[model samples]
Target: MNITTLSILQQEYPKLMEDGIIQSNVPLKEHCSFQIGGPAEVFCTPYTQNQLLDLLRFCLNHKTPYFILGKGSNLLISDKGLSGIVISTERFTELTVEQEYITASCGVTLKDLCNYACENGLSGLEFASGIPGSVGGAVFMNAGAYNYEIKDVLHSSVCILPTWESINSLSPILYLKVEEHNFSYRHSVLQDKELIHLSSVFHLKRDNSETIKRRMDEYQQKRQQKQPLELPSAGSVFRRPEGFYTGRLIEDCGLKGFRIGDAAISEKHCGFIVNLGSATAKDVLQLIQHIQEVVYEHYNVKLQTEIRFLGEM
Candidate 1:
């Protein structure tokens, strides 16, 4: 634990208590979908966009390393762990529907967004009903299943500015900086700056509420049948290579049940890497590397991981 970090956080936000923050020695395994990571130097969850901005600004001013984590569903943190701060957006959840659009804060879950749409008799987000991640995370990776993605429905977003403001609260000055951002597939202009995502606006269509609910239920069932939802795993290990599915290629290489330490290529779905009982970050990394090697050797297709690797190796 960095005493300096803790002291500064306390000074800036008196509302946060020592118990509310996690220390470096505590395992980070519980934070990720893979359940395989060491620890973070400091972990904090902010409840509002203002608090998040304050944290970001503090890190920048002090030259401390920091990370913005969401649901941690698509990440592989290293065994050596993080050297600095890790801020979780879990408490920033706020959802609302205005006319034909659904606006959600960065911490809102995809499942929550789908449920909201279903309740409101809106359609077009059924495919994401089973997606496991935060809205900011979903937008960052263009997360999809059943051939639909956030990019397909996103109207716009409220992205924060890194250098434009010293205070945590948003004002007219912050709004001006937000306007300069650009968005695209699995990316946004915010990626270049330390700015964090505040909320996102998704365009949806009004439809029969019953029909939308049915579709959502169907997608959930399909996911339950196809994915190893019962286990701990990063949903998908690799992106689909152009004209080729990563799962099929891995299966073809006869690596479906391949294991490294406690990490195994999910027998339930070859695209996933699951933790059997206790797995390490190295185990997942080795498994991914072997799969990439074997798949490339057999079919000459290089598989790229969909999961982001974090912390020190």
Candidate 2:
């Protein structure tokens, strides 16, 4: 809308921008992964839990569409720019060790968590040593790799209501915790709503710190050698179709290195759609649609998207 309307909303919702909330109309491309997306109408980074809650309430009251941004690793934002508020959880960083459990905020990256766990002599997170997404995004998608997933070790998580100032709770009003969430394969109950992830508790096993470090190092090296880390990509583009592997299917279809504008299906990994320096969101989306059509035409099974598309499609 207009600046006047935004000003009026700010006046009506003082708690949202009391400290003059961080807003940017034209942020640089390098700030986000994928190196794409136009500009955000308003980009807000709430540092505290209270700040996040207040902003959510404000967005809800104003009927302003908002999207939660984490590491920008598993998303494709429209090149036409986002029309509403962009809420960033990058400031929700907090990590603590309690007994054999590791409690980390949603903004904490998987690499950081794995390193922390290794330093503290904890196991069970070695599988996530090279994962690039943040704790919130990983947990939301039940992210997994190398035979383990977030659901395997997640004890519970704390989440805030999407449109309210309160945290998600049960019928008895129990506070949001990891166990309270209903997690499935690559999915969670929080997926249906716009809830903001606060933090998560992971129950890990105590181990030799040096040994944990060695394993993490090994996994990191393996990932660097295999994954197309040099390019901008949203990990896997499509989910496994039924009993079929997405990568194998694409490979079988001879779709490796398929290009659409600057977007190309990663030949290094068939499951990935990489932005080769100057790919637009439109190009990537078109490539995805093309892959879907071809795969469905040949195999009768429809592949699903694991990446989250934000802003306008």
Candidate 3:
């Protein structure tokens, strides 16, 4: 932010500091699974959903730029850093179980959600057990694995819209049903809508905890065997193109294990790009562009990224 904007932020939202919800120059790498990113100019982790809404309202009223961060698994942030408030939902770890249903907050990890479901004897979240992202992000992207998806069991999502763009008259919050999500492969209504996911409800079925655990463990084992889980990296780098497997194509082009700085494709799985210690965001970005170029030239199939990019490069 410029001097004027920084001054305005300090003058207008001194309460953020008092509430212990704000910090300055916080390192982004410390919070993400990739272990890559520069610093955020303003960082906030609201302890409560109400506080998050308040923070959003403050930003909207002032026309301040902001970004909402989840577990930061499927993201590639720039090393040059972000220039606005970064509100992390990492603190929103709330979970509940009622019979055959599970309600999970946006900050809750998929691993935790699956564990809770298993504990409750709820089957159907096993597919998400191995995903590294948080509930909000998963729901936003309709994250799935092993031929199963969040759309299969999601009952509804509680989303909060800013009052300025409110759809409800009495309250800005929305209880969006699963069908309203319009879920498809790696897509959701949340992608097109301006709403913040507060929580989600999953309609699962009763099952033996042992059975659920077995399924979860099986999926986890498969992920560990095929994915580059030992390294610091975002999951899959590219979406599977029609009639083509992304990993096979990259491997065919002989780009597997190719390195650019500390960034390199995983020899184990050509689909993933791993950090070979001290990789910068620029390195990863450059490597990703190179892979896309190579793969597209060879197969005439453009590789679309399954991951999201943030900040300035």
Candidate 4:
């Protein structure tokens, strides 16, 4: 643990400390969907925009390394854990419905957004009904399923860009239109930018409430039937390699049901690597490497992981 860093944060943000905004030695495993990771040095959850900005400023001023965490749906933290601070947007859960659009905070889950859209007789978000991630995470990764993506409905987003100068004079907040995001297959401009996603505006169309519900139900059914939802695993382990489905390739390589410690290639879905019971980050990593090597050796195509890796091994 970095005692000096923790002391500085507590001292600098006394009010936040008093309010229990900052926490020490938080377990990353409990926060993420994978349920596999060590501890984070410090964890902070800011409920409002101003509070989030204040935390960002403090980190900037101290030159401290920090990570912005959402629902932790698509990540693999090392067993040794993260070194610095983790800022969670979990409490930024505000949602509003306009006539033909829905605006949601970064912390709002994709499931909630889909349900809200349906309740309001809005369409276009049904594709994301089953994605177990936050709005910020979906936008950041251009998360998509069944031929639909966040970029298709996202109108704009309010983002906070970090500046190299002093935090006292913080950088201007940007209202980035969807086109400015430079979205592509499973990627967005936010990936390369030093910005914090605050909220997103999605332009949707009014549709029959029953129709929207039906579509959502269909998608949810497909997800349940095809994915290993009963197990604790990151949704997908690898990106779709051009012109080929990653799951098919892995299955063809006869690597289905392959295991390393408790981390096993899901028998139900070759695309996912699930924790049978007591999987470690090291177990998952080794299994991933082995699959990549075998698949590459047989098909001469390298597989790239879709999930982000955080912390050291």
Clashes of each: 0, 4, 0, 0
Segments of candidate 2 deviating more than 4 angstroms:
1-6, 9-20, 28-31, 164-174, 177-179
Model 4's C-alpha root-mean-square deviation from the true structure amounts to 1.1
Candidate 4 ranges with C-alpha deviation above 4 Å: none
lDDT, residue 22, candidate 2 = 55
Native-referenced Cα lDDT, model 4: 0.91
Ranking by TM-score: 4, 3, 2, 1
lDDT computed for candidate 2: 0.80
**What's the residue-level lDDT of 283 in candidate 4?**
99
Mind giving the per-residue lDDT tens digits that candidate 4 earns over 67-128?
Answer: 99999999998988887889999998999998998999999999999999999999999999
Kindly report which residue stretches of model 1 are placed more than 4 angstroms away from their true locations once superposed: 11-26, 164-185, 192-194
lDDT of 3: 0.88
Predicted candidate 2 versus true structure: per-residue lDDT over 1-313, tens digit per residue: 3365357557876766676665758552544667888887777888877777666666776777778888888888888788677778787779999989999999999989999998898999998878888998888888898878898899987776664434222221224556556777788877876567778899999999999998888888888887788998888888766789898898788999999999999988888998888999999999999999998898887989988787677
RMSD of each: 2.8, 2.7, 1.8, 1.1
Error at 60, model 3, angstroms: 1.1
Judging by lDDT, tell me the better candidate of 2 and 4.
4
Tell me the TM-score of each prediction against the true structure: 0.90, 0.92, 0.95, 0.98
What tens digits encode model 3's per-residue C-alpha lDDT throughout 1-313?
3455456666776776678888788889987888999888888898886678767777777777888899999889889778878999998999998888899999999999999999989999999999998999999989989989999999999998765555323477889999999899999988887578999999999999999999999998998889889999889988879899899999999998999999999999999999999999999999989999998898888999998899887
Query: What are the Cα lDDT values of the candidates?
Result: 0.80, 0.80, 0.88, 0.91
Instruction: Give the worst 10-residue stretch by lDDT in candidate 2.
Output: 165-174
Report the C-alpha displacement of residue 179, candidate 1, in angstroms.
Answer: 12
Cα TM-score of candidate 3: 0.95
